[model samples]
Target: MPWNWTQAEWPNFHYDRAPLERLEQQFLVASGEILGAVRHVSGEDRERLRIDLLSEEAMRTSAIEGEMLDRSSVQSSLRRHFGLGVDIASARPREQGIAEMMVEVYSGFAEPVTDESLCRWHGMLLSHDRGLDMIGAYRRHDEAMQIVSGRIDRQTVHFEAPPSVRVPAEMRAFIDWFNRTTPDGLSPVPALTRAALGHLWFESIHPFEDGNGRIGRALAEKSLAQNIGQPSLIALAYTIERDRRRYYDLLETHQKTLDVTPWILWFGEAVLEAQQVTLARVAFLIAKAKFYDVHRAHLNPRQAKVVERLFRAGPDGFEGGLSAENYIAITGTSRATTTRDLQDLVERGALTRTGERRHTRYRLPI
Candidate 1:
């Protein structure tokens, strides 16, 4: 079967706007709520929030492509980029590269999309690898770019992009369409609609040899940020990573047809879900600040150390809750000392304890 790009209507994508009307309004309302919540955060807490979100995004986006990164390294690289502070002397190339790309996307969202900008992002994303035929540039190899699965003998061709000969022209047109459909352009598409279409169009082109998936996602976030007139704090990549199977299925199905209404709807729902996750993260930060404010005076050195570790786990809380064994490991305290500290924390309302004896666990009050 021929791909959508080979058809007569090729890049002239058509989708019904009637279904997206309600979702667009919901997105705006959610954006306003997040902005309002952010105002109450202290400067220090706000910086922490930014670092956490960016680090999560950098990590998740790479994970979606089967690459796992070091959380500490990514965070440290991001902090250094933002001029917040520096801890480690150097990070692995993969960690440092993705961190640079995420920071660049967040800081330069308002700028128009250009070939140079896209190339720069591509370079940052693949700087660590030394095995690509082309890096920081479009694919020039005279072979078909096909996304495949299964064994080499019985493989399935999910989709095959246009030939290398057509990539330059195809990308030029794609870039023009993206800029022209911006909120302030000649043909202004709605925020979510533009982002969805832009992502699909870029993926269909498959301009680069590698890093297309990551760069395409960054484009979607950039589209959202541009429409909202600020950095969009949505966890788009993290949300997609949670349901990776569905994400790939949707993309594969949409690549076969031009009526992308269903794809747009799915994309909108994902964006909304991502927005909610971000709001919860912001709320968690607020609660964390208040928790520290109330319990700072009562916590001993060992108790304080354990509480800080739990907070690092974010809104999910510590996995399986903090057990007695876990506390001893973290604080290097004796069993008796761990028991006393845990009980003291519970009495002071800093931690909540549950279960009994061997099964006992503790968590933050908030």
Candidate 2:
């Protein structure tokens, strides 16, 4: 069967916007709520939230493409990009590249979608890689750009993009469509609708030799931020990463037809879910600040160090909860001291204890 891009309708995507009307309004309402919550955050905490969300995005987006980046390295790279002080000497090239691309998407969302801009983002995304026939430019190879699985002898072709000869023209039209459909453009599309369509449209093109998924997601975010008039802090990549199989299935299923109402609806709901996750994260940050304020005086030096470490793990709390051994490793205190500190933290309501004896684990009261 011919791919959606090869259909007669081709770039003229058709979706039932009626179903998405309520979702679009919900997205805008959630966006306003998030902004209001963010405004209540102090400056220091707000900057920290930005770095956390960006780092999470960079890490999650890359992970979706089967690349595992160091969280600290990505965070350090993002901090440096924001002109904040950070020890970024340990950051590798891959982490640095994605971090740079993410910052560009966030800061330059309002810029027109031009080939030069896209290529710049492509360059930054693949700056460290040495293996591709093309780096900053679109794929020019004659062989089919196919997403396949299984062994070479018995591979399954999931999807094949438009041929290389057609990429330049396809992308030119795509860039034009992207700009003209912006909220303030000659033809304004709704925020969620445009973002969902932009992502699906770019992924269908798969213009580049590599990094298409990552860049497509970035484009979606840029669309959202452009409509909302701010850097969209929605955890889109993080949310998608949670149910990756379904995400791919939906994309594959939708790529076969121009009637993409299902895809648009799914994408809209995903963005809404991502927004709620981000709001929870902001609320967590606020709770963290209040937790520190209330417990700071009662925590001893050792307890304070351990508590700080736990809070650094974010809203989920430390993974598997904090064990006594973990406490010793963090504080370098003796077993007796560890026991004393843990009990004191539990007594002061700074931490909640579960299980007993060897199975004991502690988590933040919040």
Candidate 3:
């Protein structure tokens, strides 16, 4: 559907009042570690959460299904996300951590920030190591790459922008605003509000030729990261990726007037919604962990291997995830046996199907 968009204003966007308050309350409930202070997580505080969730043992063991994440990718993506100049890092670093952090920014409980902070966020997202080398850019710069995602009828764009459309005048001002304004200490407007502003401003400018929407989202996420000082955004993009049609609709609606309120409200609503989803995911994860505790005895060696492989990429996988071929290579098993193992996992509730045939993906169940 040609990357259509829309915008609107709900005045006191039902999101800011109702959804936000509920989200705050729910966050207090989910955090469990700190009820009162969960509303104001700092950078250090955020690292603690990471340490707690992804400790030395946890980092090594944590995986979807029975599969675990490759530490190398994680480290590579982290370095790239931080603008760490790549010396000999792998070509496609693990970006899930950065992606996860971007999702978590949806929660309103973030720290204060400014324009420079925003640009810095963008820099991190489109860092020299991570971003493309575009018009005069050292990183990947060539835009106009068609990275279309979402539904067939209402497909959303992940379009590559033209160099001519690189960061324009007003947009440059906006980035400058973000860099100059956001600071370590400030009367914080809601992070989600700033996220909305950044999203609209970034997209309107169409800064780079490619990855603008994704980068705009990364921009929203960075604003939230600046606000909370925490790097993990729970699931905002997954949410946006899920409801991509409506998101584009709202953008198109708002673009008609160039107003920002409707978009802000929608963005806030998105953050709140992501919180609800992550809360459920956390609960499911804990439940599954408990299941493992009790039923680890019931799982067989191959069954366990199947599960472990799913996280890294089994035969049927997507994104940067592993594939069945990867699984076959890793496990050194025959295709017939591997396919059987994969199908069994899907039936046994160990692996969930993500795609089909050549494009199929499977991972830990939702």
Candidate 4:
């Protein structure tokens, strides 16, 4: 019963432009802080952070679509892309497909957007799902596309896309606007605002039969990268996943109104949350680096390898700390040797021991 953004007589957006100036200023300052923190890290640390953050984005974005990917496989796929050493097993085609598409999104953020480019992205995304005949093309059928919930008998339509007949024209207009008014272009609008509006517009069109959400997010990533002057390690989808209820509710509510201030406000907040989260991780990484630097000389090869793996496991370091049995399995050491190795680590103040006997766990002293 409600008119979408494309259906209004004026069909243009209205918002409090003055309030957005503050948001733009905040985003710029945060972006500089993130980039500056990145510059202070070692090149190897920076590379690892890039790979970890991009892999986290790929994994979380896929999870938002109800698809869970093995994080190691995603990391392996990215390593192969960057010519880094990959120690993991070969990834499945589906996992590789997801990772490959995300890698392309990360690496190609500076490239221009076109219908063909979007089609190719869609093709890559669905390559492992759809049949050969259905890849790399827009919807050809005239069926109504509605996002609905609840049972079939009582389904509630949250949104309905434009008819397939008008999809081409709609897509062309959207792409034209996107290319003409880029973040660095003559447009007075801030780049983050453009990213949010573009995301809403793309979702309303729903040009493809699948993967529209992923593509829209990819477009947002490109927009932010363009605005900030480099590809970012902060993953917006991570924050979206954390605030998914609000994310969905805002989109559902705002899509029906020409004034989309609420959605834009939520998007700005989401961007801030993502950067704040990344900033915390950046601090954790710096601490971890200092931790290693302090203990690097005291560690033997086995202890170093185990410490590195645990650190890479994340800030918590191995869910419950690495068990001695698990350590032996990983280090291929005998029980006696593993016991002495762990005790030596504890004695050297590199690790703290918890529990006793078989339940014993060793974690970083910090």
* Global lDDT scores for all candidate models: 0.92, 0.93, 0.50, 0.81
Please provide, for model 1 over 38-76, each residue's C-alpha lDDT reduced to its tens digit, 9 standing for 90 to 100: 898999899999999999998999999999999999998
Report the candidate with higher lDDT, 3 versus 4. Answer: 4
lDDT of 2 by residue, 148-169 (tens): 9999999988899999999999
Q: How many backbone clashes can be found in candidate 1? A: 0
Across residues 1-366, which tens digit of lDDT does each residue of candidate 4 receive? 574745564247777777777787888999999999988888888888888888888888777778888888888888888778776577777677767777777788778788888999888778888454457787767678788899999999999888888888888888877877766665635866888888888988888888888888888888888777788668798888877778788888877887888788889878888888888777778888888888899988998889888887776578877898888888898989888889998898888999988888898865
Q: How badly does each model clash, as a count of residue pairs? A: 0, 0, 59, 0
The whole-model C-alpha lDDT of candidate 4 against the native structure comes to 0.81
Off by over 4 Å in 1: none
lDDT of 3 by residue, 156-269 (tens): 765332244433444555655665545354334456665676676566546554345655665665665565555433456656656667887776655445445566666777
lDDT of 1 at 74: 92
Candidate number with the higher lDDT (2 or 3): 2
Model 4: lDDT of residue 302: 91
Superposing every Cα of model 3 onto the true structure, what RMSD results? 10.5
RMSD of each: 1.0, 1.2, 10.5, 3.0
